[model samples]
Target: MNRCLISAAMAVFFFFLAWAVSLRQALLFLVGIGLGGVLAGARFGFTTGWRLLIENRDASGVMAQLFLLGLAAAVCMPLLAAFPGELGAALGPPSYSLLIGAFVFGLAMQVADGCGSGTLYKAGLGIPLNMGILPIFALGSFLGSAQLEQWLQLGSIAPVGLVARFGLLEAFGITLLGLIALGWAALRWSDRIAPWFNKKLFIGAMLLAVLAALNLIIAGQPWGIVYGFGLWGAKAATALGVFDPTANAFWSEPVNVRTLSQSVFLDVTSITNIGILAGALWIAAKRKVGAAEPRSLTGTQWVVGIAAGFLLGYSSRLAFGCNIGAMVSGISTGSLHGWIWVPMAFMGSLIGVRVRRRFNF
Candidate 1:
């Protein structure tokens, strides 16, 4: 896979999307490629970032994340406000499901060693553990979505949109302030001598923020990861005659039903996800020889890691999104559930990191 071959293949795929799907989907695929490239090239690992913060008191990764959040909010909030009719935000209810889901997702991600996007990019990079976990993650996501209505029935509240409730300026201000406060807290908790910034990470955050804004603009929705995984699982189950979309509350919706019948390339998230994979593959192909070999795991470690991947998928649906869907898109778009998702997931990560350590992962 030379760069020329990768570029040609991507171009051919883009033409297929434009011809068979729509130009918008084609462009989104490109955006997804950019996302994959940046994520893999920059080594942007949300799960690893949190783990580093917890285990090493390192703030560099966390701070880079905060920068990403803030930058994305700066761009996305305004677009959401201006195009309220055309664009939609990532909004999820504040529910018992969220509390439980986010916590478990955080914990599971730590053990699995990847969140939604992290898993995707790493899988694209041909990491054996993540590649193995991908299907299990999809299965868990489908199961979680199938049972989501029941989870909400336990207890939930209406989703709150800061932009809608507080107006654009106020919502944006609050988002930035919250990020700044988090950055301060991360700094305080970090090792005194630990570096606060890395040039590569900063550039990565900037590029990702811009790319996320592009996704929102082109797709008429914020960037997401897990929904696509769940959808893939649902499609597989339906093909196997093991699942009924009409019976499941989440999958029974008009839109969901329509999406199920259509080609996955027509689905916004799926196309982007595919693009991310392609982009990552491109990066992997171009890498120099002698890249570090993946670590080998014991049988028990393999079981735990794979099982954790399942939990990651299931919990992401319950949580309304993973780090990308919930935290980045949620907070950037002014959804309060995103705000609620953070601390709960962080608490889960606190426990997850310990479990990871216990297993010596």
Candidate 2:
């Protein structure tokens, strides 16, 4: 559990990835580690941020998040524009599924006390509830993806890419303006005496923005979390004969089929997801002994929390992604659905905070 030992293990894994996989995957693993460290070290919880804003009128976390989005977009949009052929955005359709799914995901994340990245990092940090929720979340994601085709039948328009439509400078300007506006609004709604900034959160936002940009450059795609979870679930289900990839519309695609056949370390998202876990574990190992421990939940609380975790996975798939994927990656890359996802998810968070309170979580 020594920091040096953890670093050595991470380095060994990095070399293994470079030797066995590609250099790109190895570098991405490093990026994922950076992301995990920032998220864990900063205590940056998107769910907690929204809940704080709702309950205590605190805007510091929300402002930090807005800064992260703006900074990430400033870097990402140009890179995407420069290498349009090589880089891809986290685009998702603005459909009924998005609305319903984002809302449900918002609610579920609150009840579960973690979003996708939040859950992963917290589990890595040895949080009991999140560790238990991880597999259930994967199962929910897999089931949700399996049923995605049906959700789309409710009606969806084609995805809109802002950089493609408005040009890089225009899209970047719009993204920055939107984030600034949101920050302003958060401040306006905040408690008069509430602290508007935190040094740690600000630093975390800057580091995350840089790391996220690195993830996009190395992976050739925006950073994501849920797809890896869904893939894990699919792999498990397929191995158990509980699911058939050929039968599921989403999994039947040639690309998906190929992905299913390959090792998870080869998958861009999966590699990063694993790296996040490892990085967070590294952070956990560095923490002072017995500094804090996760609170215990009653049996009923555990059941509700676990069920919410399942819903988090299912709704994230339906919503096209979670806080990290849909909101951060999507917005940073100029996807319109990412813009739409925020308000809906926030609305759900409003109700979610109430539900979380009712459950005394």
Candidate 3:
């Protein structure tokens, strides 16, 4: 019964969104649906993966994350370097912007109990807190983007692509080696870690990596989450006459302007984001996942979570991507900032976990 309802909902949504936009949008949405299913089913998540590694010393999730990065880098680097048109790399600069933003995002994710992708997928699964967090995350994303230009001016350097620094062969070689070492280290630390790979999760990880790479190929950019949220919020604010897209530096770009003018289905990331939500809902329901249990959000919990969501949004923009954009695609694309983000965010997550206990979140 649950599966049937999910399927029907997906079909109706696909038709309406497809009718409203292009076939490409429909395809992206399908990819998002797959991502939703895979994430929920496999228990794949950056935040949960990191948290498990940090708190429980379980390396399984982190190892899978590393594998996702390795495979994605192997596939995506070549395409980005060789095929420049349309398939552009997500190149974020290395600077204080990243250091500060990613750290705050790390902390916020812990407080909110979900990263960008985690938040979206869980909300789709009807997690009450995340359901509350999503809109605020969106609003925060808009506010973040609005201030992005000013933030970027704070001790930033131009984006550096490994392909540009070292030739394609060298770049791929370096990335592959780094991923290997990172994966090994993660497993070594976790006494409770399972085998090198789980058959079920391996397939899911590979599929996700491939889909993310395809996202780059089709959308002409790497997989990302926050931009779509920000765009949604900005659009809403504009509708309410509280904001103007034309004036904001972030929204003034040609591509951004086009995104603003068209239906959300026409926007690549947004298309996929909506897909992820619906897809996760479908899978969760099918798996007998209930809406976030009746845990009511207290006043303090709400304040903390909402504030954290806002920071997650603001910091993600300043840093150039969230977990998906900055960490996964960043390292895959061979950006130094991606490397920089990992440690900073990890340290922040450490702090966030401690803080979270206070709020009992």
lDDT of 3 by residue, 1-361 (tens): 3778779888887887668777777788888998888887776778877787788887777788888898999899889878867577778989888899989999899999888888889898888888888998898889989988888888888898897799789988888888878887887777743554666667878999999987888778889999999999988999999988888898999989988988877889898898889878886776544534658878999999989988888888888889998999899988888888988998899999888988998
Badly placed stretches (over 4 Å) of model 3 are 192-199, 289-294
User: Which of the two candidates, 1 or 3, achieves a greater lDDT against the reference?
Assistant: 1
Q: What's the TM-score of each model vs. the native?
A: 0.98, 0.98, 0.94
Tens digit of per-residue lDDT, candidate 1, span 144-252: 9999999999999999999999999999999999998999999898896989898899999999999999999999999999999999999999999999999999999
The order by descending TM-score is 1, 2, 3
| TM-score quality measure for candidate 1 | 0.98
Q: In candidate 2, which residue ranges exceed 4 Å CA deviation?
A: none
Alpha carbon lDDT at 186, candidate 3:
83
Candidate lDDT (C-alpha), each: 0.95, 0.93, 0.85
